[model samples]
Target: MAGESTGKKKKTGMKSFIGGTILTDERISRQFPFVVMLAMFGLALIMNRNWSEKTIRQIGDMQKELEALRSEHATISARLMDASRPSEVAKKVNEAGIGLKEPVKPPRKLVVEDN
Candidate 1:
Protein backbone atom coordinates (compact mmCIF):
# COMPACT_ATOMS: atom_id res chain seq x y z
CA MET A 1 0.00 0.00 0.00
CA ALA A 2 2.83 2.45 0.93
CA GLY A 3 4.70 1.70 -2.31
CA GLU A 4 1.54 2.24 -4.36
CA SER A 5 0.90 5.58 -2.62
CA THR A 6 4.45 6.80 -3.26
CA GLY A 7 4.20 5.95 -6.95
CA LYS A 8 0.90 7.81 -7.18
CA LYS A 9 2.49 10.87 -5.51
CA LYS A 10 5.31 10.92 -8.07
CA LYS A 11 2.87 10.67 -10.99
CA THR A 12 0.79 13.50 -9.53
CA GLY A 13 3.87 15.66 -9.22
CA MET A 14 4.63 15.30 -12.96
CA LYS A 15 0.98 15.78 -13.85
CA SER A 16 0.74 18.95 -11.75
CA PHE A 17 3.77 20.47 -13.50
CA ILE A 18 2.48 19.63 -16.98
CA GLY A 19 -0.96 21.03 -16.17
CA GLY A 20 0.42 24.40 -14.96
CA THR A 21 -0.71 23.75 -11.41
CA ILE A 22 2.92 23.75 -10.30
CA LEU A 23 2.76 27.54 -10.06
CA THR A 24 0.23 27.20 -7.26
CA ASP A 25 2.44 24.80 -5.30
CA GLU A 26 3.54 26.11 -1.91
CA ARG A 27 7.28 25.67 -2.60
CA ILE A 28 7.16 27.41 -6.01
CA SER A 29 4.93 30.23 -4.79
CA ARG A 30 7.48 31.04 -2.05
CA GLN A 31 10.20 31.60 -4.67
CA PHE A 32 8.04 33.61 -7.14
CA PRO A 33 9.78 36.89 -6.26
CA PHE A 34 13.20 35.39 -7.10
CA VAL A 35 11.89 34.17 -10.45
CA VAL A 36 10.46 37.62 -11.23
CA MET A 37 13.76 39.24 -10.31
CA LEU A 38 15.62 36.94 -12.73
CA ALA A 39 13.18 37.85 -15.49
CA MET A 40 13.78 41.58 -14.88
CA PHE A 41 17.52 41.06 -15.05
CA GLY A 42 17.16 39.30 -18.39
CA LEU A 43 15.05 42.17 -19.76
CA ALA A 44 17.60 44.72 -18.57
CA LEU A 45 20.44 42.85 -20.30
CA ILE A 46 18.54 42.85 -23.60
CA MET A 47 17.73 46.55 -23.33
CA ASN A 48 21.36 47.42 -22.58
CA ARG A 49 22.59 45.53 -25.62
CA ASN A 50 20.07 47.29 -27.87
CA TRP A 51 21.03 50.72 -26.53
CA SER A 52 24.73 50.02 -27.03
CA GLU A 53 24.21 49.04 -30.66
CA LYS A 54 22.15 52.18 -31.30
CA THR A 55 24.88 54.38 -29.80
CA ILE A 56 27.55 52.69 -31.92
CA ARG A 57 25.52 53.27 -35.08
CA GLN A 58 25.05 56.93 -34.20
CA ILE A 59 28.76 57.33 -33.59
CA GLY A 60 29.56 55.84 -36.99
CA ASP A 61 27.18 58.27 -38.68
CA MET A 62 28.68 61.22 -36.79
CA GLN A 63 32.19 60.18 -37.80
CA LYS A 64 31.19 60.05 -41.47
CA GLU A 65 29.59 63.51 -41.19
CA LEU A 66 32.69 64.87 -39.44
CA GLU A 67 34.95 63.66 -42.24
CA ALA A 68 32.71 65.30 -44.84
CA LEU A 69 32.72 68.57 -42.94
CA ARG A 70 36.51 68.47 -42.59
CA SER A 71 36.92 67.94 -46.33
CA GLU A 72 34.59 70.87 -47.04
CA HIS A 73 36.53 73.08 -44.64
CA ALA A 74 39.81 72.23 -46.38
CA THR A 75 38.34 73.04 -49.81
CA ILE A 76 36.92 76.36 -48.64
CA SER A 77 40.18 77.29 -46.91
CA ALA A 78 42.14 76.60 -50.12
CA ARG A 79 39.74 78.75 -52.16
CA LEU A 80 40.01 81.59 -49.63
CA MET A 81 43.80 81.44 -49.69
CA ASP A 82 43.80 81.60 -53.51
CA ALA A 83 41.38 84.54 -53.56
CA SER A 84 43.38 86.60 -51.01
CA ARG A 85 46.61 86.73 -53.03
CA PRO A 86 47.84 90.20 -54.10
CA SER A 87 47.70 89.35 -57.81
CA GLU A 88 44.20 87.93 -57.52
CA VAL A 89 43.04 90.97 -55.59
CA ALA A 90 44.53 93.30 -58.21
CA LYS A 91 42.92 91.32 -61.00
CA LYS A 92 39.52 91.44 -59.33
CA VAL A 93 39.88 95.17 -58.71
CA ASN A 94 40.77 95.76 -62.37
CA GLU A 95 37.87 93.59 -63.52
CA ALA A 96 35.52 95.63 -61.41
CA GLY A 97 36.83 98.92 -62.96
CA ILE A 98 37.16 100.38 -59.48
CA GLY A 99 40.04 102.63 -60.60
CA LEU A 100 41.99 101.92 -57.39
CA LYS A 101 45.75 101.92 -58.08
CA GLU A 102 48.66 100.41 -56.12
CA PRO A 103 51.19 103.04 -54.89
CA VAL A 104 54.53 102.89 -56.73
CA LYS A 105 56.49 104.90 -54.11
CA PRO A 106 57.62 103.43 -50.81
CA PRO A 107 55.80 104.85 -47.81
CA ARG A 108 57.78 107.66 -46.05
CA LYS A 109 57.61 108.49 -42.32
CA LEU A 110 57.75 112.14 -41.23
CA VAL A 111 59.46 113.19 -38.02
CA VAL A 112 58.55 116.35 -36.07
CA GLU A 113 61.13 118.11 -33.80
CA ASP A 114 59.50 119.72 -30.79
CA ASN A 115 61.44 122.57 -29.07
Candidate 2:
Protein backbone atom coordinates (compact mmCIF):
# COMPACT_ATOMS: atom_id res chain seq x y z
CA MET A 1 0.00 0.00 0.00
CA ALA A 2 2.85 2.37 0.82
CA GLY A 3 4.60 1.66 -2.46
CA GLU A 4 1.42 2.24 -4.42
CA SER A 5 0.88 5.63 -2.69
CA THR A 6 4.48 6.69 -3.39
CA GLY A 7 4.14 5.75 -7.01
CA LYS A 8 0.97 7.82 -7.35
CA LYS A 9 2.70 10.85 -5.81
CA LYS A 10 5.67 10.44 -8.10
CA LYS A 11 3.39 10.31 -11.13
CA THR A 12 1.70 13.52 -10.01
CA GLY A 13 5.01 15.30 -9.49
CA MET A 14 6.30 14.36 -12.95
CA LYS A 15 3.58 16.36 -14.76
CA SER A 16 5.19 19.83 -14.53
CA PHE A 17 8.07 19.26 -17.00
CA ILE A 18 6.98 21.95 -19.48
CA GLY A 19 10.16 24.15 -19.32
CA GLY A 20 9.88 24.64 -15.57
CA THR A 21 13.26 22.93 -15.05
CA ILE A 22 15.02 25.10 -17.63
CA LEU A 23 13.50 28.26 -16.14
CA THR A 24 14.52 27.31 -12.60
CA ASP A 25 18.00 25.93 -13.38
CA GLU A 26 20.64 28.13 -11.64
CA ARG A 27 23.52 27.28 -13.98
CA ILE A 28 21.85 28.74 -17.10
CA SER A 29 21.11 32.49 -16.93
CA ARG A 30 17.77 33.45 -18.48
CA GLN A 31 19.21 36.38 -20.51
CA PHE A 32 19.81 35.38 -24.14
CA PRO A 33 16.27 34.27 -24.97
CA PHE A 34 14.89 36.98 -22.72
CA VAL A 35 16.75 39.62 -24.75
CA VAL A 36 15.50 38.02 -27.95
CA MET A 37 11.92 38.11 -26.70
CA LEU A 38 12.35 41.73 -25.63
CA ALA A 39 13.74 42.58 -29.03
CA MET A 40 10.74 40.96 -30.74
CA PHE A 41 8.35 42.81 -28.42
CA GLY A 42 10.16 46.09 -29.12
CA LEU A 43 9.95 45.53 -32.88
CA ALA A 44 6.24 44.79 -32.61
CA LEU A 45 5.75 47.97 -30.60
CA ILE A 46 7.60 50.04 -33.23
CA MET A 47 5.54 48.59 -36.07
CA ASN A 48 2.32 49.26 -34.18
CA ARG A 49 3.37 52.86 -33.67
CA ASN A 50 4.06 53.22 -37.37
CA TRP A 51 0.67 51.73 -38.24
CA SER A 52 -1.10 54.06 -35.80
CA GLU A 53 0.70 57.07 -37.27
CA LYS A 54 -0.38 56.09 -40.75
CA THR A 55 -3.94 55.66 -39.50
CA ILE A 56 -3.79 59.12 -37.92
CA ARG A 57 -2.60 60.58 -41.21
CA GLN A 58 -5.44 58.86 -43.04
CA ILE A 59 -7.90 60.25 -40.51
CA GLY A 60 -6.53 63.74 -41.07
CA ASP A 61 -6.83 63.32 -44.81
CA MET A 62 -10.42 62.13 -44.41
CA GLN A 63 -11.20 65.20 -42.28
CA LYS A 64 -9.81 67.44 -45.02
CA GLU A 65 -11.88 65.60 -47.59
CA LEU A 66 -14.96 66.00 -45.43
CA GLU A 67 -14.35 69.75 -45.17
CA ALA A 68 -14.00 70.06 -48.93
CA LEU A 69 -17.17 68.08 -49.46
CA ARG A 70 -19.00 70.27 -46.97
CA SER A 71 -17.84 73.36 -48.86
CA GLU A 72 -19.14 71.91 -52.11
CA HIS A 73 -22.39 71.05 -50.37
CA ALA A 74 -22.71 74.63 -49.12
CA THR A 75 -22.10 75.97 -52.63
CA ILE A 76 -24.69 73.67 -54.16
CA SER A 77 -27.20 74.43 -51.41
CA ALA A 78 -26.73 78.16 -51.92
CA ARG A 79 -27.23 77.81 -55.64
CA LEU A 80 -30.35 75.73 -55.10
CA MET A 81 -31.63 78.27 -52.60
CA ASP A 82 -31.17 81.07 -55.11
CA ALA A 83 -32.81 79.08 -57.86
CA SER A 84 -35.85 78.39 -55.67
CA ARG A 85 -36.75 82.10 -55.39
CA PRO A 86 -39.95 83.14 -57.24
CA SER A 87 -38.24 85.69 -59.53
CA GLU A 88 -35.43 83.30 -60.43
CA VAL A 89 -37.89 80.48 -61.07
CA ALA A 90 -40.00 82.74 -63.28
CA LYS A 91 -36.95 83.92 -65.17
CA LYS A 92 -35.76 80.38 -65.71
CA VAL A 93 -39.27 79.34 -66.80
CA ASN A 94 -39.28 82.12 -69.34
CA GLU A 95 -35.81 81.15 -70.56
CA ALA A 96 -37.04 77.56 -71.01
CA GLY A 97 -40.11 78.88 -72.99
CA ILE A 98 -42.63 77.63 -70.45
CA GLY A 99 -44.90 80.16 -68.66
CA LEU A 100 -48.53 81.31 -68.23
CA LYS A 101 -49.92 82.34 -71.62
CA GLU A 102 -53.40 83.15 -72.94
CA PRO A 103 -56.08 80.69 -71.83
CA VAL A 104 -57.93 78.47 -74.40
CA LYS A 105 -61.52 78.02 -73.21
CA PRO A 106 -63.44 74.82 -73.99
CA PRO A 107 -66.95 74.79 -75.69
CA ARG A 108 -70.07 74.61 -73.49
CA LYS A 109 -72.33 71.51 -73.58
CA LEU A 110 -76.07 70.63 -72.97
CA VAL A 111 -77.63 67.27 -72.12
CA VAL A 112 -81.12 65.78 -72.56
CA GLU A 113 -82.66 62.79 -70.69
CA ASP A 114 -83.27 59.53 -72.61
CA ASN A 115 -86.13 57.30 -71.32
Candidate 3:
Protein backbone atom coordinates (compact mmCIF):
# COMPACT_ATOMS: atom_id res chain seq x y z
CA MET A 1 0.00 0.00 0.00
CA ALA A 2 2.82 2.47 0.78
CA GLY A 3 4.52 1.66 -2.48
CA GLU A 4 1.28 2.14 -4.45
CA SER A 5 0.52 5.53 -2.80
CA THR A 6 4.09 6.77 -3.41
CA GLY A 7 3.84 5.74 -7.04
CA LYS A 8 0.71 7.89 -7.62
CA LYS A 9 1.19 11.73 -7.99
CA LYS A 10 -1.24 14.00 -6.05
CA LYS A 11 -1.57 17.78 -6.72
CA THR A 12 -1.46 19.82 -3.51
CA GLY A 13 -3.49 23.05 -2.99
CA MET A 14 -0.41 25.34 -2.64
CA LYS A 15 1.32 23.66 -5.55
CA SER A 16 -1.68 24.08 -7.89
CA PHE A 17 -2.14 27.78 -6.82
CA ILE A 18 1.51 28.75 -7.24
CA GLY A 19 1.75 26.82 -10.50
CA GLY A 20 -1.18 28.91 -11.97
CA THR A 21 -3.34 25.81 -12.50
CA ILE A 22 -6.11 27.14 -10.19
CA LEU A 23 -7.37 29.56 -12.88
CA THR A 24 -8.36 26.64 -15.09
CA ASP A 25 -10.78 25.32 -12.45
CA GLU A 26 -14.47 25.06 -13.43
CA ARG A 27 -15.71 26.97 -10.36
CA ILE A 28 -13.57 30.07 -11.06
CA SER A 29 -14.68 30.13 -14.71
CA ARG A 30 -18.35 30.03 -13.67
CA GLN A 31 -17.92 33.13 -11.42
CA PHE A 32 -15.80 35.15 -13.86
CA PRO A 33 -18.70 37.30 -15.22
CA PHE A 34 -19.91 38.17 -11.71
CA VAL A 35 -16.39 39.29 -10.69
CA VAL A 36 -16.06 41.49 -13.78
CA MET A 37 -19.48 43.11 -13.07
CA LEU A 38 -18.47 43.90 -9.51
CA ALA A 39 -15.28 45.57 -10.69
CA MET A 40 -17.24 47.76 -13.13
CA PHE A 41 -19.66 48.84 -10.40
CA GLY A 42 -16.78 49.86 -8.16
CA LEU A 43 -15.20 51.96 -10.92
CA ALA A 44 -18.52 53.73 -11.62
CA LEU A 45 -19.01 54.56 -7.94
CA ILE A 46 -15.57 56.19 -7.73
CA MET A 47 -16.22 58.25 -10.87
CA ASN A 48 -19.57 59.51 -9.55
CA ARG A 49 -18.03 60.68 -6.27
CA ASN A 50 -15.29 62.55 -8.13
CA TRP A 51 -17.85 64.32 -10.34
CA SER A 52 -20.01 65.39 -7.39
CA GLU A 53 -17.04 66.91 -5.55
CA LYS A 54 -15.96 68.82 -8.65
CA THR A 55 -19.43 70.32 -9.17
CA ILE A 56 -19.66 71.41 -5.54
CA ARG A 57 -16.32 73.19 -5.79
CA GLN A 58 -17.44 74.98 -8.93
CA ILE A 59 -20.66 76.18 -7.26
CA GLY A 60 -18.70 77.55 -4.30
CA ASP A 61 -16.37 79.46 -6.61
CA MET A 62 -19.29 80.94 -8.53
CA GLN A 63 -20.98 82.08 -5.33
CA LYS A 64 -17.84 83.95 -4.27
CA GLU A 65 -17.60 85.66 -7.64
CA LEU A 66 -21.25 86.67 -7.51
CA GLU A 67 -20.79 88.24 -4.08
CA ALA A 68 -17.84 90.29 -5.29
CA LEU A 69 -19.79 91.51 -8.31
CA ARG A 70 -22.75 92.52 -6.14
CA SER A 71 -20.54 94.64 -3.86
CA GLU A 72 -18.91 96.32 -6.83
CA HIS A 73 -22.29 97.18 -8.32
CA ALA A 74 -23.47 98.73 -5.07
CA THR A 75 -20.32 100.89 -4.80
CA ILE A 76 -20.68 102.12 -8.37
CA SER A 77 -24.38 102.93 -7.91
CA ALA A 78 -23.64 104.98 -4.78
CA ARG A 79 -20.90 106.91 -6.55
CA LEU A 80 -23.19 107.65 -9.53
CA MET A 81 -25.95 108.95 -7.20
CA ASP A 82 -23.53 111.24 -5.36
CA ALA A 83 -22.04 112.63 -8.57
CA SER A 84 -25.44 113.34 -10.18
CA ARG A 85 -26.61 115.77 -7.42
CA PRO A 86 -27.37 119.31 -8.65
CA SER A 87 -24.81 120.92 -6.30
CA GLU A 88 -22.10 118.48 -7.37
CA VAL A 89 -22.85 119.15 -11.07
CA ALA A 90 -22.72 122.91 -10.57
CA LYS A 91 -19.44 122.65 -8.70
CA LYS A 92 -17.87 120.60 -11.50
CA VAL A 93 -19.15 123.07 -14.12
CA ASN A 94 -17.72 126.02 -12.18
CA GLU A 95 -14.38 124.25 -11.84
CA ALA A 96 -14.27 123.82 -15.62
CA GLY A 97 -14.88 127.66 -16.06
CA ILE A 98 -17.34 127.22 -18.95
CA GLY A 99 -18.96 130.61 -18.11
CA LEU A 100 -22.47 129.05 -18.10
CA LYS A 101 -24.88 130.25 -15.35
CA GLU A 102 -28.36 129.38 -14.03
CA PRO A 103 -31.23 131.65 -15.23
CA VAL A 104 -31.98 134.59 -12.86
CA LYS A 105 -35.54 135.33 -14.00
CA PRO A 106 -38.83 133.38 -14.06
CA PRO A 107 -39.97 133.72 -17.68
CA ARG A 108 -43.58 134.57 -18.70
CA LYS A 109 -45.60 131.90 -20.45
CA LEU A 110 -46.68 132.46 -24.10
CA VAL A 111 -50.15 131.47 -25.33
CA VAL A 112 -50.95 131.10 -29.06
CA GLU A 113 -54.46 130.77 -30.56
CA ASP A 114 -54.82 127.72 -32.76
CA ASN A 115 -56.38 128.37 -36.22
lDDT of 1 by residue, 1-115 (tens): 5546443343337889899988877778999999999999999999999999999999999999999999999999999999999899999999999999878898999999999
Candidate order by decreasing TM-score: 1, 3, 2
**How many backbone clashes does every candidate have?**
0, 0, 0
Pairs that collide in candidate 1 are: none
lDDT of 3 by residue, 76-111 (tens): 999999999988988899999999776679788999
Q: Mind sharing the TM-score for model 3?
A: 0.71
lDDT of 3 at 100: 78
lDDT of each: 0.90, 0.77, 0.89
lDDT score of residue 85 within candidate 1: 97
**52 in model 1: Cα distance from truth in Å?**
0.7
Q: In model 1, state the lDDT of residue 89.
A: 95
Name every residue pair that clashes in candidate 2.
Answer: none
Q: What TM-score should be assigned to candidate 2?
A: 0.59
TM-score of each: 0.78, 0.59, 0.71
- The Cα error of candidate 2 at residue 58, in Å, is 0.4
Q: Top model by TM-score, which number?
A: 1
Candidate 2 per-residue C-alpha lDDT over 1-115 given as tens digits, one digit per residue, 9 for 90 to 100 = 5546443322223444563555454333557688789999999999999999999999999999999999999999999999999788777777889766433686668888999
Flag clash pairs in model 3: none
Give, for candidate 1, the lowest lDDT window spanning 10 residues. 3-12
